[model samples]
Target: MNKLSLFYLLVMVALIQISVPAITVYQNEMVLYKGSEFLFKTIPLDPSDPFRGKYVTLRFEEEEFETLDTSLWQRNESVYILIDKGVDGFARVKRLSRKPMSGNSNYFKGRIKSFYLADGKAIISLDFPFKRYYMKESKAPRAEAAFERALRDSGQQTFAVTHIKNGKSVLVDVKIGEISLKDVVSESKND
Candidate 1:
């Protein structure tokens, strides 16, 4: 190829690389059990950014993981979450633990907190990195509908938030509280 063409190609490739979101592996490679459930005790947080829109941020309290064999598991690796909760209470998630509960003195009780699956990452939903996920008004119709359906079926507000198994994210479901999300858009309209 000509030098000018080669330079242009290189620039295009560089820009593409820079623009893509970098995949961050979980500090502890763990996979959540597919049929398990969760109930996180939400620790209230302050408003983040306008771009994020609105959502009731959370810190998970109960993370019920699928019982898996020690051999199939990996330490600190991320696994896909499945099955959201219903109004009755409880959300099911994939069993993804940092390390096996084997030989540990502490019991992996239902009180297990600080873990969630969103945006293709296994998040602990802590102070430092896990951030509120919000979506544009135009996108919420489908996203909210699916979320609502899952919530209805489970009879709980707790989410069975799952990651894309194929690793190709056509639509990343940004969780926004129904009330909070409505308020943000409605207030703007009234104004």
Candidate 2:
């Protein structure tokens, strides 16, 4: 192939590699937004990345599987987890199954972390798909600081707004005390 042709091919390949995941994420998010929305309580931490800008590290509240049967469980095993709103109005894991079930409940695909025990409970650690919510560089710091202050206040709660569809999940927003991070930053600007 000609040098110019080869160069163009390389560039196209690189672009595809970079853009495919981003495009997939956007598409998945759109699906989630159009589907069922769920809430999961979270503890947020902020950190900056040179390439991806700043994002909040999300640790979900429902990481422990209270009634999981470990007999058939294996390290790094893939599982389909059912999601339903709890009495507190937060989305929580209803069950883990080897295959996705059809019903009104939402589901997400996750992997089981290696065998472990905690507090006399047979814990099944889950690795959720969406862990970080990327934010604009300028706004991330403000959001982080606000979240930290809210965390210190006993009245505030931090939670992630997640949406699920067809066993796919997306993190739509991170909220502090019922206000979204973006809105909180904008509200601060008016004060």
- Give TM per candidate: 0.33, 0.78
- The lDDT of each candidate is 0.37, 0.81
Candidate 2 global lDDT: 0.81
**Candidate 2 lDDT over residue span 1-191, tens digit each:** 99999999999999999999989988786767676888888876788788988887888878767763545578899988898899989988878888878865488888987556656555787878778889877887788777787788765878898888777888889898778988987887677
**Model number with the top TM-score:** 2
Off by over 4 Å in 1: 1-6, 18-43, 47-57, 63-90, 94-131, 134-178, 182-191
Q: Give the TM-score (vs. native) of candidate 2.
A: 0.78
Backbone clash count for every predicted candidate, in the order shown: 30, 0
Across 15-93, the per-residue lDDT of candidate 1 in tens digits comes to: 8776563332221122232212223322323233566564434344433342323324333444333334546454334
Candidate 1 accuracy as TM-score: 0.33
